[model samples]
Structure formats: structure tokens, C-alpha cells
Target: MTETHEIGMVYLAASDLELADAADDVRGLPVVTQLGHRLGEVEDLIIDPVERRARLLSVVSGGILGLGVTERLVPVEAITRVDDRVHVDRPEPAGDGDGRHRGDPADLAEEGYQPELVDRPPFAEVYERYGVMPFWTAGYVVPYFLRR
Candidate 1:
């Protein structure tokens, strides 16, 4: 049996838990911006145990042999579609083409920085960055794509 450990909101990695359907697993899929920019790959799913659904996607990018990889939590509501790649409706960073807009989660990860995942503060920041409602907030709903 998979063991789940709860923190503040009880977010756990989907890799350590059970997926309702194996085919629905998107752990290895590439995450792309709406403009077709490659952000990263889905490292894991952060699920809310109370809701029994995915709330965030642990996206990993920019690392050599897993040494300097950066992981960022993305709200599942940011996902626009899912096929071979997980497409997100995220805006491109506005800058001098360095792709480093201040406070942007994708840009932050590209800079090889991993955000803290076990806290509500970071979770709130991610949800705000993605312009999505937090799972803990009122009127927040899981995306239809993840409903299965």
C-alpha cells in the first residue's frame, strides 16, 4: 500500500500514491506554454488527499543529469489540454528574450531554482502566477481534464 504523509494541506506526490488509471498518468509528459515554448516535463502530481484529486503539477526543468534540476508547482487549472504534451495557457515572459520574468514560476524553474512545495505560501504564489484559484479557496474547482 502507498503511504501518504500529510503536511499543512496534505499535498503528496502522485508517484508515491496510486493513480485512478495508469493511462491518465501524466508524470513524464512535456509541459509547454501556450505560445509553444517548452517549459519542462511533468515530474509528479501534487494531489490533495481530502479531495482525492490533483491540485498541482510538479514540473522539472533545466538540469544536468538530475544534479541541478529545478522543480516548480503549477496549478492544474493552468492546463489547457493534454495529449502527447501537457499544454498550459500560460503567458510568455516579458523581457529581453531571457525568459526570466520576475515571479514567473516557469522562468524561475528555468533559472534552476526549485520552489518549496510543502507550504501554503508557495502554493498561493503559484496559483496567483497562473491566474488560477487555489484548491483551498472558495469556488476553486479541478479542471475537467483531470476529472477522469
Candidate 2:
């Protein structure tokens, strides 16, 4: 549960990854479990420039007509593979009893930051002011999705 504020990138311009250097285009790709279950579509990637690797992926979960869509942060470490789709081991059931989804801020750090994820009230206040919850508080575990 460590937390760091390293700058990252969110590629929302395309539905696929289009790096010139052979990097996998994960945008719009469906994230699935090893057992073959649709989780959700990758909306964006959080890249750590210093580490020269992707730190996290922004996955878009349930929503209707572009409304009530929740964004979840998936640590790169959790991703087991990225072939035709991003593969990840199943996550444990979320049971904090807070009635909200949450992730660890520590996972957001690229490296060198692994203390503990601290709650920043300022961020919470900002989210409250904007009528939006922080990504971490939204949900930590990825939810299942049915492919169309």
C-alpha cells in the first residue's frame, strides 16, 4: 500500500497501441483471465518514463451509454502476459466492507517507492469537490465482462 506521484501517460487517442518501436498496442484490447474470461477493455496505459516501462493500465469497467463508467488501475506486475490480449491472474475477492472499490497507491509507483499507500485527504477532497471518486477508491480488483 505504498503511494507515489510519479508522472504517467494516458493514451486515449487510439483504440490500440501504436508505438513505432514494437511496443504492444493494448489500447481497446480486452483484458482477460488465464481461464479465458473477459474483464474489460484497456482504456489507457500509465507509463513511467524513468523506469522506461509501463507501470499501470487504466481499465474501464461497467457503464451504460458512456455513463457511470468506472476506471480501475491495474499494476503491470499483475499482468502475466500480453499476447493477443492482456492476461492476468485472477484477483482475490474485494472485501474491505467499505462498499467501494480501491487499489494500492504503491502499485502506482514505478520503483524506489514501496513504503505504504497513504491516504491523501487533499485528493479525496478534490474528488469530492468534483463529484468523482479517486481511481484507487473506485476498485482494486478487475471485474468480469461478457464479450459481445
Candidate 3:
């Protein structure tokens, strides 16, 4: 099987999901840039099952009739502000051509993910392939700031 499929399997293999149907929390929230560039809408939030916090912001952009819909995963740190709209900073230059930010795998090591898991093959590759940051890679403070 292709590595991409294997990576997806890893995600599926996760038995302990943080929030059952996390998308409900942030669905319909407009995500924009500091300049008010309508990046997209918050399709879902990938939460760390262990941390009970969001690890990635899944943004959906440029899709019609479910034809060309694309999901971009942004690191929680990229979020500069959140209120009526979920505001995020511009992605770094290292992003993929699709305008999605590519999170650094090294941060995973610092985030205290199990060494065995981080060191294993395909974890980092999977994360890089999807351009998402592992939730364990950073501290999440957005949930507290939001008006629950």
C-alpha cells in the first residue's frame, strides 16, 4: 500500500479521539487573515485526544458541489485572534502551493509526544504530507479565550 494510505490508516487507528465530532465546536466560523483575507471557513478542529484541546484548524477553501474542496490544516499557534471570526496569521514561506502552512516535525519532539511514536516511520511523514501540526507540539490557550 502507498505511504499516504498508511498514514491515513494511522489516523484511523487512533482509538481515543479527543472530542467526538470536534467539528461541531468550530463549524461555520469564518477564518480570515490579519488583512481580512477570507481564508475559508473552519470545517473542523483536530483535537489531541489526550490534551482535550485543538491541535490543528482544518480550513476548507475553494470548493463547489463537493468537487474541488480542499482541507488545509493550520497550527493553532498561527491563530492570532479569535472572536466573531477565527483570525490566523499568514503562513510561512514554506507552505505548499495550495497556501496551506507546513508545520515543523521537530516541534513534535518538543511537545512530549511518545518518543517511540515520534521516532517511528510515517508519523512525521504523515503530518508533513497533510501539512498539519501535532496537537501535542504546543500549548493551546484559544479555548479559554473564546466566549464559551
Candidate 4:
């Protein structure tokens, strides 16, 4: 089942749904920027239940034993290739002193939070960073890779 957010979009954690094709599953795959900088590994997908496609990649990085880990959401449009690793078209953000990017922490969702509770600001930043049109916009097409 999908939950609709205040933004009027229906999103669900892919972990809660089964994929029609197991081979297309991207969870657990490492994510890299265009320069091959390791960003993190995909922990789950934020999928649009109404569209039946993935919208965002929930990537987890920088933590030991799950402590202090950061989760960032990347719009699917940022994905350039998907094979051994998920390659994004953007470059890594410059780091802050703490080894995390400045402003990056603002993108994080609360742990165990429902997808329907996701806010818009972080998603806006993600789409801007990736230069991808938001799915809600007219003329936005589901990326070919995510169609399956």
C-alpha cells in the first residue's frame, strides 16, 4: 500500500514492496559520482506507488555498526548507469570539516520515518544538484532504467 504525503505524492519504501524482476533490484549496490567517488550504497528505493517506478535512491554512508550513518536521497534522474555500481552524473559535494558535506546533513530523513512524511526542501536540493526535472513537472519522463 502507498501513503500519500502532504505534497500529494504517493511514495513507499521499496523494501515494503516486491519487485517484479529480482535482477533489476539495485539495493545494496554502491553509488558513485561521475568521477567515481564513492558516495554510499543504496539501502532502499523510495518508489512512486502510483507510477510503479522508483523515484529516489536511499543511500547510506559513513558509519560503523549503523551508528552515525548518513542517508541521502538521490533522485533517480541522477543515475547515469547501473551495473556493478550505480553511477550518478553529478560530482561529489565538497566536504565539511566533519567529513560530511556542508548542507548534506539537511538532506537526511529521520530514522524509521515513513516515506509519506518526507519533506520537500531536501528533495528540491537533490533535484537541483542532479539537474533533473522533478517527476511532478510536466514533460518529466520516468528514466528508462527505472521503467522496468
Best by lDDT: 4
**Model 4 weakest lDDT span, ten residues long:** 96-105
Report the error of model 1 at residue 32, Å: 0.3
* Per-residue error (Å), model 3, residue 59: 0.4
The superposed Cα distance between candidate 4 and the true structure at residue 103, in angstroms, equals: 18
**TM-score against native, each model:** 0.68, 0.50, 0.53, 0.70
Which residue pairs show backbone clashes in model 4? Answer: none
What local distance difference test score does each model get? 0.62, 0.47, 0.49, 0.65
Task: Write down the TM-score for model 3.
Answer: 0.53
- Report how far residue 72 has shifted in candidate 2, in Å: 1.2
Higher-ranked by TM-score: 3 or 4 = 4
Off by over 4 Å in 2: 1-21, 92-148
Better of 3 and 4 by lDDT: 4
Report the lDDT tens digits of candidate 3 across residue range 1-148. Answer: 1112222322212334444444326657988877888878876554454444555555767754444554565555566677779876654324444233323355333543321222233334434544555433576344322323
- Give lDDT for model 3: 0.49
Task: Name the lDDT value of residue 41 in candidate 4.
Answer: 92
Per-residue lDDT of candidate 2, residues 1-148 (tens digit): 1123433333323213333323644778888866887767786655434433444556666755444544555555456677778886655224322112333444433354222223322333433332333444546343221011
Higher-lDDT candidate of 1 and 4:
4
| TM-score of candidate 1 relative to the true fold | 0.68
Clashing pairs for predicted structure model 3, backbone only: none
Scored against the true structure, residue 118 in model 2 reaches a CA lDDT of 30
